[model samples]
Target: MAEHRRLFFALWPDEALRQQIAAISATADWPRGARRVPAAHLHLTLVFLGDVPAERVDAVRSVAASLRVAPFELSLAGCGHFPRAEVGWLGCVDAPPALFALNTGLRQRLRTQGFALRGESFRPHVTLARGLREPPVLPDYPPLHWPVSEYVLVESRRGRAPAYTVIGAWSLAPVSD
Candidate 1:
């Protein structure tokens, strides 16, 4: 049997940002049995490439490396819940154009490389809590600004806690004024 790994591309936050995100998550009034994502594992997934065969990892990395998008700032404000998924999240209310462009272009590139992907619209968000029976009434939060500079490929390992291993990273091009 071919070895397969669960993979995804995401924007990994720095320690300072991670701490800030964790702090905000701490303040949320989560219902009982809700599992808050650990600060170390907090990230905004750009693309989910589920269960890729070991030999195909290189192709996935190459697709990310070919990205020529520029860095952009993302402001995550407010909270929302996916009723069907029962997932609580923080998201960008007014996202910048570059963010969408980056996702669209990246997905296109990956698809062109013979990777199968779901045709779902991209909603920029960070999962804060999961396994909620009902949506918790969340307080209004000030926008958290994130200066996104790079995107990375990550491997998800199943365990008691959420564990993610960064496989590779590609820095976005610096903006030229």
Candidate 2:
């Protein structure tokens, strides 16, 4: 039997944009127990598939590669904590329609291929930090602009500090000027 891989779909920013987004973490005072996510690990998850068997990886890859979306812009702004989940996240003030369609397309294909995702609602956010003891007052900040061109399938390997590796990426159609 093939080993299962913890997998998810994410919108990863280019290094420069990633740095811009990561800087937002420094501006806030998190609640006790908060652990800020490292700069390299910052990404907005499109859909999280907890685990998939080794044999099914190709099927997942095919589904990802088949998706069709035009490139769109993403605006990350504002930071807040989910009091219950203790996750402090940064998110877009205006999530574009293309983002929603891309998400739905991936979910539909995955479901047909026998992968069931855990969550019912899809809220677009990049988790900045976690383990918040209490929700702090959120702050308003200028939007961090990131152009969404492609999304990747990431594998999370367990270790002292879990490592996330991009296994595959699919590009969206480029918009004509």
The predictions' CA RMSDs to the true structure, in order, are 1.8, 2.2
Per-residue alpha-carbon lDDT of candidate 2 for residues 33-136, written as tens digits (9 for 90 to 100) = 78888998999999998889988999999999888889999888877777787898887878999999889999999999999888778889898888886765
Look at candidate 2 and give me any clashing residue pairs: none
Positional deviation of 75 in candidate 1, in angstroms?
Answer: 0.6
**What TM-score, computed on C-alpha atoms, does each candidate reach?**
0.94, 0.93
Q: Count the backbone clashes (under 3 Å) in each candidate.
A: 0, 0
Candidate 1 lDDT over 127-163, as tens digits, reads 8888877775567667888998898999998867658
Model 2: C-alpha RMSD to truth? 2.2
Look at candidate 1 and give me any clashing residue pairs. Answer: none
lDDT of 2 at 126: 90
